[model samples]
Target: MDTGVEGRKASRVGVRVSAVSKTIKGNRVLDGVSASFPLARVSGIRGHNGSGKTMLLRAIAGLISIDEGSIEVFGEKLDARGDFPVGIGFMVEPLELWDEFTGLEMLTLLSSLRGRPRENHLRSALTRMGLDPDDLRRIKSFSLGMKQRLNLAQGLMDAPRLLLLDEPTNALDEDGQEAIRQVLIEERDRGTTIIVVSHDREELDRIADVQFIMGDGRIREV
Candidate 1:
């Protein structure tokens, strides 16, 4: 990974949550789960199946309809309607993508959705992720690894402040996984707050500054 980017801050920021909780179908999925993320550091959410790791991240990203408690990014509380998930970026478990759209087309549409994502930045980000522009021409027809690469490119397009990734290493080869690690490190260095839910302990150990273990919807620091 290249930690060679200039014009970046040396110190990382902080993310805090207060009295946070979430439930579904009368079942409390996340129980009073609250934690903080330090700036320019990688945090890991590790847990077994159905442990609410994804749910917690979803709530933080405003993808899930949060009903209880609150989330804060950079000391600001997020209301459902406004300033929520401040400077956040995320990719969930199910891997949402427009199958019929070419990789370039998909990214272009995403750029349009967020006002405007520099055309040059999009190509550069994809290159940094080890993807060729040619890959976009047939991305939907590519394998899972290709799709994952596209996803990574998409999430990093806007260079969001807080990034949430669920099982990002899955469907990737060793080289691809290493590439992602490098990118994550570089992004953290660029002051992007990151939270990843992964099953690989060794891999998480390499990236996480803070780690959490989840159980029965409750989370505790490891």
Candidate 2:
């Protein structure tokens, strides 16, 4: 794959975690984590299970509050007591979907909650992910790969300025994985700030302009 943008760098920080820490059930899930995810680039995070990768993403997405330190998105400090970062599209792991709803129906419902994106836009998102928007099958009948693609389509449909994905290629085959890589590259080129969490080191290396390793609640660049 073409190495992201020709001259991309962390010159402008999109998401900044400043000495952030989080504790849960007497376990430190985040330990003074500080990192900068640059704008218009793909930032990758990889770690073993329970290594705080997801928790960090949660903090960035404002889904969870940090016990210590702070987080800023696009130069605005995030307030846990306030609203989430605007213009962000996040798809976390353990994909959740309305089993009884068809792909189109689900997208329509979600879009309604988010200002009702046009019907064509929703259909286009599904088609881009290789799903038939007119298909009548319910999500419960979809294969794991299909579900993963739907999850990605949900996050990408609106073309948000910031994209946060967790294990985006989970359950996808080789061809599906390649499609995801290309989509990420395209998003980066469009100046969308992306932070993706994956367990596959090789896959991250292929798409990420910068990569970080999370272990025992701490992170270091690699």
Candidate 3:
């Protein structure tokens, strides 16, 4: 995608949040946060623990309902009735996987739940994530980094228009982290709108087209 000033000016907004707020169990997690993410760009969010970065992503993904305000994805307003945005791929923190399934088997099962993706496509996704698609080891035997890769592969295999990732580099080594960075950049260049949350400021600076910092349930562009 174009990074020039005119190109940026011509870009359309992919996700828009209007005065959104959410309180969970009497604790305010998001305090009237509002932001716009441009299509075909990588937007990065950074904040300390409990600063509501993850919660904000969750709200955008429609995994949690905002107590007030509105969120729109590709011009469609998100409903409070747990309706997820169409054409979205998200991998939030606290990864969950089927412990009894192998990497390929798990992804195959997940893809089956949505639509019938080719078996070869599933294998290619695993290979791109540096996983051995033919490995028969169960997920329970995989290490933390391997599990993280599997989680990302599942989210990205479908090639959605919008991608939301929270701490995508967690548990990854230097090479693995670099691989993810390249993948994010490649996706952005392919006109995919990406919103990523990371604690590494330097990494965000390198990959993010725009950056936001969250504190005390509030957000400010940085």
RMSD of every candidate to native, in Å, equals 3.8, 1.7, 1.8
What TM-score, to 2 decimals, does candidate 2 have? 0.94
In angstroms, the error of model 1 at 82 is 8.6
Better of 2 and 3 by TM-score: 2
* Model 2 spans with C-alpha error above 4 angstroms: 1-5, 8-10
Which residue runs does candidate 1 get wrong by more than 4 Å? 1-13, 81-86
Residue-level lDDT of model 1, residues 1-222, one tens digit each, is 122444233434466766677778998888888787667678898998889888888887777766677787777777744343546767886766888887777788887877766877778768877877656465558789888888888888777888889888889999999899989988887878788998778878877777888888888888
Displacement of residue 21 (Cα, Å) in model 3 is 0.6
Quote each prediction's TM-score: 0.89, 0.94, 0.94
Tens digits of lDDT, candidate 3, 147-171: 9999898878788899999999999
- Clashes per prediction? 2, 0, 0
Q: Which ranges in model 3 have alpha carbons more than 4 Å from their true place? A: 1-10
Q: Ranking under TM-score, best-scoring first?
A: 2, 3, 1
Model 3 TM-score relative to the real fold: 0.94
In model 3, state the lDDT of residue 113: 77
